[model samples]
Target: MRAAVYRRPGPAAEVLEVVELEPPEPGPGQVRVRIVTSGINPTDWKTRAGYAGRMPDGFQVPHHDGAGVVDAVGSGVAGLAAGQRVWLYLAAFDNRYGTAAEYAVVPASRAVPLPDDASDDLGACLGVPALTAAHCLGGNPEALKGQTVLVAGGAGAVGHYAIELAKHAGARVVATVSSDEKRALAEGAGADLVVRYTDADAARRIRDFANHVDRVVEVAIAANLDLDMAVLGSSGTIAVYAAEGELALPVGEFMKANTTLAFVLLYGLSPGQLADAIRWTSGALAVGALSALPVIPYPLEQVAAAHDRAAQGIVGKVVLRIAGN
Candidate 1:
């Protein structure tokens, strides 16, 4: 099988190489998928750069989200079988053998049946961003309904879904974008209020618009913590997806308000949690309540370029078309 293998933890092009390796077969509880598409996320590049200072000891593949057909199934895998079309999550999160290849063998539990109406590209892109957004919004059910929820970085892939899901769950949604163009996109995604964050008064202005937001779906918690602390309602939950900076908490503000800080990690979530997220997200997708974010598509051989594009801030999900059925 041909795969994009990482030899080191440096620049993407220098370390990630397309090379032929032995094809893997499914283990007792696994399935071998002929990958049709692989979705790239920020974590893919961060992992390659060794953010935690841990690099793979040997050659390893990268990428966690994938859409593929089950070409083979192993013993003890009951419900799924060969020829099933599926969307995979956590494909290469903890391990090095991810989905950026001609074939990938993952645990049966990691694969979910693709919706009948969902395209492969959509399925591939939903695993990380959509699931994260749905999980964050769905975590606190009672307060989400009839509450004003602010989604920070609204034009982002995850933020876009956060807006949609919050609206679907009955929240009065407000989204903050960094530019005028993105404000329109946020509105299109159903945000009731769109706040532009281009001023020193942005946080104050946002508070004026929302009055008090009951929840915040935060993307850059580190960058936006002060503003978030200032605007969130008392007892509100700030579900942060990416902190990407110092781990210190807003001790004074949060303690004063008794706020709840809920951190979300889409990949590596426990099985039960992921199952519930998948159930809701699948329902939303099936009913057209959730829209797949814009995708920049590339052929399989352009995998490196896809990764670069994703890192360079492509508007939405970056999908690599592995093969066409």
Candidate 2:
């Protein structure tokens, strides 16, 4: 098998390369997938650059999401078979081989079967942002029916999926975007309301749009903390995923409103939280609630470009098209 391997942390072009290696056979409870599309995410680049944490030593394949066909099932695996099409999530969570290659090996449960009608593009987009969205709201989604939810940076990968997932769970989702283009993207994703994050009256409008903000799925929590705290309804939970730095809480106001501040990091999600993300995201994908995100493709040979593109904080998903259709 051929894969994008990084020996050390640095610029994508400087550190990443395609190398031929033995394709991994599935372990006792894992399955080997012939990767078609490897999804590039911010964390992939972050980890590669040692920005997320210290870079691992030795050869490492990157990417956590992919869509592919099952080629080999491990001895103890059940409910999946060779030739089945599946979407993979957390492909490199604790493993060395990730989706940024011709093949990847992951646990049986992480290889979700794809709906026949769904495109490989959609399947490739599901794992990280979609699951992260699900993890953020998965705990109390049932209670969110008829409630109002605010999603910061709605056009972002996580926030884009959050808008649709929240709506599918029956919340009236209000999304904050930086531009008209993003506003349209959020609207296309089924957000009930769209507002500019920089507007002077953004808080007032968000509060008015939904009566009160019942939940907030924030991508840029540090940048928008004051805005979120201002419009939060009583008993609201603010699920924050990304932050710039330390967040200073308004203890008195937060206490008075009984607000719950939550954080989501996909790797640290508890088993129950992960299960909910998988279960509910599966339903949403089945019903076409989750759509294919805009993609910027790079061939496996250009894995460095894929990493660079994803790290640019652009308005689309970056993918390594490893295998041709």
Candidate 2 positional error at 196, Å: 0.3
Candidate 2 per-residue C-alpha lDDT over 101-208 given as tens digits, one digit per residue, 9 for 90 to 100: 989999998899998999888889989899899877755568768888899999999998898888888889999999998998999999988999999999999877
TM-score against native, each model: 0.90, 0.97
Best by lDDT: 2
- Model 1 per-residue lDDT tens digits across residues 246-299: 767868878899999998987657878888777777667767777667778877
* TM-score for candidate 1: 0.90
Q: Name model 1 segments beyond 4 Å from true.
A: 138-143, 199-210, 247-250
Enumerate residue pairs that collide in model 2.
none
Error of 1 at 290 (Å): 2.0
The reply for model 2, stretches above 4 Å from the true place, is none
lDDT of 1: 0.81
